[model samples]
Target: MTDDAMLTSKHALVTGGGTGIGLAIARALANEGAKVTITGRGQDVLDAVSGAGIHGAAMDVRDEASVNDTVANAISARGPVQICVPNAGIAEGHSVHKTNLSFWRNIMATNLDGAFLTIKACLPGMRDTDWGRVIAISSIAGLRGLPGAAAYSASKHGLIGLIRSLSEEYMGQPYTFNALCPGYVDTPIVDRNQDTIAQRTGMTKENARQLMIDANRHKRLIDADEVAAAALWLVGPGSHSINGQAIQIAGGQTA
Candidate 1:
């Protein structure tokens, strides 16, 4: 199939699709002719990016009722969701000593619980179809412990575990489950992290940002589109055997 028609009739639901990696992936799917429903907490943000085969739905991933209702509405409008991308998450860093129970729960609720709810809501529709893809946006922290980010790292690690188990559960089926572990992507999240790091470490914002850039072997921050390209590839042809994997998109080896 032509690139523009590869996802022609498929419906894709991307949470946290208003900005950054989620937005990039949503746009990529839409360009390939998927009816994309991009959800976020901000209605205006979603509206700004709506159209051109992409629709918008304001939903909070942390809220179970909102996730189920919004997903059902999306399915009713656009048909079964063949592609589910759970990318909504917070990337805050705090040492384990400083992290409170509430803070840790918030991280898990948005990052891990959110993915579980999204996949659960969309899986039935996907199962009714002949093919399905559940691509969870994990982090490099998921593969390795990130210093001073115990809660965030744990949430991402849980996400990868969930994806891996699902992949095993549905082995040999037309559906595939995988997680994308990206490192230091140049997105709004990184920008926020830079500021946070600066305040926490008493360094200039530039130095804080440089710290992330240096983390990558390429010595530069990864573009959001680079991660988006990986998502597109997973949904594209010849990716059937790529299931149950934690594909890393760091500039080089993370281990």
Candidate 2:
């Protein structure tokens, strides 16, 4: 296909596509002519975003059965999934002293295990095709430790590790695997985090929010489309050789 319709016959599956960064990427892929299946646990949220070239499915990435069933349904509806974005994840900051097994498990389940399941289910279809892309939405914490967010940081770190291993596993193949590590994106997750930060640190909500904004090198939250733009680049032209990379979206050096 031409660059104008590079994804004309492709099918893309994005988890947590109902809102935030995932939704932005779904829209971007659809805009490029790929049939997109945006999945979330809430059917209403998914349906609300379904239109144009984007469809919605209710699937919990934490469940193996749900992941498999949802991927099957997407294939039945839009053909093989040439693009997969495991963008669904939860972000919360907790000190190591306060982190428990349940908290650790939950973060790992949604962020790490979820990516594993999503990629495992989608790889077969991708392997059958001539070209495919797997883009995992990791975080800046994955590369550097974020104060008071030990569990969240660990989960994201594991995600990048998974992406790196897969990229090597398929080194000579047509499929490419990469992770996006963005700092303090402007999303619903950030809104919730601000509230948590306020409660935990006794800062006002606005101050808590500003804390994240200040974390970025540019002193602002990153737009969701900026992350989507990176994903589009990985799946778009000139990306075949850009595998196994953690593309940082922060304004400047994080470490």
List, residue by residue over 126-169, the lDDT tens digit for candidate 2: 99889999999999999999989898899999999999999999
Q: How well is each residue in 1-255 modelled by candidate 1, as lDDT tens digits?
A: 365598999999999999999999999999888999999999999999898988999999999999999999999999999999999999999999999999999999999999999999999997898999999999999999999999999999999999999999999999999999999998999999999999999999999999999998889999999999999999999989999999999988996
Best by lDDT: 1
Relative to the true structure, candidate 1 reaches a TM of 0.98
lDDT of each: 0.95, 0.94
TM-score of each predicted structure versus truth: 0.98, 0.98
* Residue runs of model 2 more than 4 Å from their true location after superposition: 1-4
Q: How close is candidate 2 to the true structure, as a TM-score?
A: 0.98
